[model samples]
Target: MPAPRMSTEQEIEALDEVCQRLAGFEDAISLEWLDGYLTAIVASPRRIERDEWLAKMGQGVFARAYADPADAEQAIKVIDSRFEVLANQLDPELILDDADVLRLAPLMIELSDDDKKQLVADGHIKEDELHLLEQTGEVWAIGFMDATHDFPNDWPDADLETEEGQLFDECMLRVVSLTMEPAELKEVFDELYDGEELTREELIHEALYAAQDMRLYWLDHAPKPPQRRVGELPGRNDPCPCGSGKKFKKCHGAQMQ
Candidate 1:
């Protein structure tokens, strides 16, 4: 039997616990970043293997051995669950419902007063500018960019020639712009938004829309999984469905026998 599905609140609580446990590690990504990473994977043009993507997560933190094996296992389980949830939300075959749409939304990071104070101390922003910045979605954007960088070949500059491709490019740029410094972001805003300043909410809205568009684009453009007859197995000489170059008889079919 399949495992029980977790509610949105339950998932949030689970992710929060994992993040809290890893608080000492500066490089450990938060729930927001993980959400963006999983979103990119769901919308990717090619299917990424579970092991490969999990290793790529948090710069391979999830794949590393921990002092407490149970802690590592628990964290991995939460990450896996989140990935599964995202995959289901973006499944092309399903009609998007209200609940699915809500679940598909990105987990944006909101900066608290303490966080803003730290940013000022760290020289990331001015104390006066703290009031201007709300939830910037910077961390989530970085996570999305990381996933794209992993599979650079999948998103090519040549795509910019098409209308849909251009839109995709704009969307990606909008989200990535959140990662820029304030001065840099101002320049981008002038170029992309006709010198009109955007609020943090507007920027985050763009990021959310970009993610939705990416899912739609990949649903239409990505290679479809090969159709198979029900209850039929691959022929001994056929290419393995697992995507291995080896023939069936030389791969998983060999194990069956």
Candidate 2:
């Protein structure tokens, strides 16, 4: 028998069904800007454009469609996450409905309601809403995603061979945990070494160095509250790094108090 082929029409139809379900989202994003947003996401192999670039690309009307510039930026984030989930699916037409939603669910880290009270008590972040940091992993970006999906790239595998490589892998996790504003994060990832596989031994060394430097740079610049290996941690907002599928506030973070 001949090998099977992926039907492009089916993929398009599956994405169309998802778009249909986002009626409320389109209303939130304003129907006027929705068409342009969808167009840009489906177009190219380049890194997804940041909001600054998208607004410029969309010209004046996209901003006019929203209440304010910040609202428009958030709408762009919602667009980014949804389309990225669709793009990640190779055979979305065959996907389990619940699995897709779970995969596409807003990258959320729930907060401690009590922590919100304490922050107000201590005069830290003023509002409960401020506790929600808008963070998403852009590992779903078109360039990186395409490169990994079609080619063999060793971009993010933890080496099972050596202990030090394992340590570097852990540090790598911390680097990703650091919160970068969405557009800036996408832009930074797009620039992480030309999106190419580094074959040279020296280049691999440099790649490893980049990972190390990334952790250090963010540690110094975006210092988060130190994480605990044990008891009584305080006032933290990041997702638990333990990979337990629970947000930090609901997981190990909850017990810290």
Candidate 3:
């Protein structure tokens, strides 16, 4: 038999009892299971009525408690802290693609720029694509990509501790300026010289050299151009300085010799 429909207040009180009773277990049953239970508890599914309590309270309450999940770790502590013996759970994978993003608590959320970047990188639903029964987060009844929302004005929204991936403006500008300016300046040098010097290939070689980390590392340590060898020079017929221990005439110096 269908459970008798009660007034909104009665249904909410009944929902609390249901939650408390289920919190009996040391480990959490699936939240979907809870949703299914409460869904069948108060009223018929076909009715237009919504349960004010369960809509706001279900899995969302649990997800929010462990928002930055890395911190509050143990299942025992989580359930014991808030609900006492009512409920305890761990690692709710509420964010679909990037589990780093914590769950969505509300029935709706407007996507932020960070959210869009994460959606694209993680290969979940995109903003332009369609045919959603409703856009949803892994937890709660979140709807994404909306322009305006009807929920609480001050609800906390966002994935805590998701690293800000892109560089700041000043850092980005410096990277572009340092890497590109030398290449551009080479063109100017070529024009001024009437293309007589610094061929395109030569400019590419110079640009690549300038971009090299190894070249930069040695730049300050490079020996100054020598007027002549400061140390002794091997005679043409002497053993090679290259450690082949053969005569200089027979090794690396052989071409000159």
Candidate 4:
């Protein structure tokens, strides 16, 4: 047989009991297990519905003795901390391949620009290809190529300047902008012209992690560029700085010696 539905007062009493038991255990425990255990006591097989009186007795013990309420406070904190950990583990970045994206185009076309950008930021879709999913009243279709894709022949060449191309460009820019905060993003923006081979994703992740630690603005104290040393002029018979097989006299010796 099913257990009777708990009344509001009965639920409060049950919650108090659980909270009291939780306060007693100093060690960390799985919140899922604890919730299930509490529910089981009130569930059909056990039918221990009036556990609130037990809870009140526990609370009276807790309140009358301890000089400080640190234990009670910590009990609530641990539950919240466990819940957050679980939530983070459950939600992770999604990876979409070309075919997977194409399949989603119809539903995606209806989403607004902000939502599209959010999807890209969350790793659900590629920034460059998201704008391609534009929708008419009932039709959804691919857009055009952009400078970012280097104008691949996969898409029509002339469509590069059309609404589709513009939309694609806008979404890409928004993805870049939304990937990190301003100061964090600037490191990557600077890196773009620094001639390094680092990928955009790598740079973005580093910047975001730095921002989270509140150390993003620091330059990391890179070693100063080494100074070049001036040397004495070489004689005509000396080895040449040009690294030629011939001595200086035979290799631009007149120009230096």
Candidate 5:
């Protein structure tokens, strides 16, 4: 049987423990960033292996490692559970529960009062600039963009020639805009939003809509297996009928013998 779904409170507690454990590592990503990164992996047109994405978790050349091996294993379990939840949410055939929709909501960067004051005092941002910072989803967008950046070959430029492709391109641009520096953001916003800044509510809505569009686009466009005649077995070297991109012999076919 499949694993039981985690309760909302349980999921929160597990993620909190993960964040606390990784807190001491300067290069480790925040929980919000991890959420976005995993969302991108789920929405990817091609399946990214768990180990491959896990290795890319750190900020620079170094990979994030837990001091205790047990902690690492436990953290991976939590992260993998979240990954499965995201993948299920994007499955086109599945009817989402209310809780699933709630889980789909993007995690945004929330600043403590002290963090706000520190930013203001350092002149990194004006006091007023901190308003609605929690709803902007900037860090989440950065993490999403990072995944796309790392796999440029996997995420090719959208075909502007078709309406659906054009819409997909627009959605991608909207998400990428959130990751821009002030000057870059202004340039993109001017073109995409008629030079008006998006409010926090608008940003949140746009990000959610973009993610939905991504799910739909991939469902329609991802590669499919060839049809087979009734009772005809798959060739040993053919792509697995399960759509895993592995040869038949290495996938489900291995179970037959």
Candidate 6:
């Protein structure tokens, strides 16, 4: 038999009908019912954008959208517990939704390549999954899993609504995380940033390292309280690495306590 046609609109219409029926029975559905409804809708064969669907269902029901695929329930618990730590340490604005969190959970947990494969098996990321890193708030690293180049060679000129554009936006976000400023980070990326122009892994590595160094400079030198890591200590033994002639023990070190 021939394969069935995939029509997203039909699936959407069905969901709408179900929602209408539920609304008729009750003015408002509980969060549990809404979640069950969304899960059933996406678990189907229709390829839907997870974020858009969640927004439609109401932000509360879809909040768990970014849970880790390996241990979805546990991941949510851990994230909530750790969210305050992040807010207190780095920019609280770095907060993410369920879909974004899931997309990034593997990286956050520092999973090995083998573990990543297991996550795929666990449905953490789909086999056809593609991602784009935010290089800066304005520039993204767009690419696909089953394709070449991460983003379009001509980016902004490309149709922003197309799959290519969405991929580009995702990549830009990834790059933003790398640069530590989604919207304003400098674009030090070379043409090689696009896989099509150059695929050397070393080049990509060097580019990221350079971007990190820039972020470090901003964090350390900017007048704000440096976002020092927990247990991180500046060299008290050295010449106060902040370029001051005074010993670190006499300068920044004295403030350490």
What order do you get sorting by lDDT, best first?
1, 5, 2, 4, 6, 3
Candidate 3 per-residue lDDT over residues 116-167, each given as its tens digit: 7677678787657533312222111111101003222211232234422111
lDDT of 1: 0.72
What is the Å distance of residue 115 in model 3 from its true position?
Answer: 0.9
Candidate 4 displacement at residue 229 in angstroms: 60
Q: For model 4, state the Cα shift of residue 14 in Å.
A: 22
Candidate that scores best on lDDT: 1
Candidate 1 has which clashing residue pairs, if any? none
lDDT of each: 0.72, 0.39, 0.33, 0.35, 0.71, 0.34
**Runs in model 2 lying further than 4 Å from the true structure:** 1-43, 56-58, 67-70, 90-257
lDDT, candidate 5, residue 206? 78
TM-score of each: 0.66, 0.21, 0.17, 0.17, 0.66, 0.20
* Model 5 CA lDDT for position 236: 89
User: In each prediction, how many residue pairs overlap at the backbone (N, C-alpha, C within less than 3 A)?
Assistant: 0, 0, 1, 0, 0, 27
> What is the C-alpha lDDT profile of model 6 across 1-257, one tens digit per residue?
11212224444344344434444544343222332233223222232344444344432332444344554444334423332222222221232211122111101112355865786899778756613322221111211110112112212232467764454444433333333332222332323244233222333334333223322232323233337687656677778877889988999899866
Model 1 agreement with the true structure over 1-257: per-residue lDDT tens digits? 12323437888889867765554463547777767777788778878887777666666665443448787777778877887877766665452333134335567778777888899999999988875664458878887888877766655452677897787787787878777777888987898799898887877776676676676777566654668767788999999999999999999999999
Runs of candidate 6 with Cα error greater than 4 angstroms are 1-73, 77-198, 223-257
lDDT tens string, model 4, 19-45?
446456522212222332222121111
* Residue pairs whose backbone atoms clash in candidate 3: 23-86
User: Candidate 3, overall lDDT?
Assistant: 0.33
| CA error at residue 112 for candidate 6, angstroms | 18
Off by over 4 Å in 3: 1-73, 84-110, 130-257
RMSD in Å for model 2: 22.4
Ten-residue stretch with the least lDDT total in model 2: 99-108
State the displacement of the C-alpha of residue 26, model 4, in Å, after optimal TM-score superposition.
Answer: 38
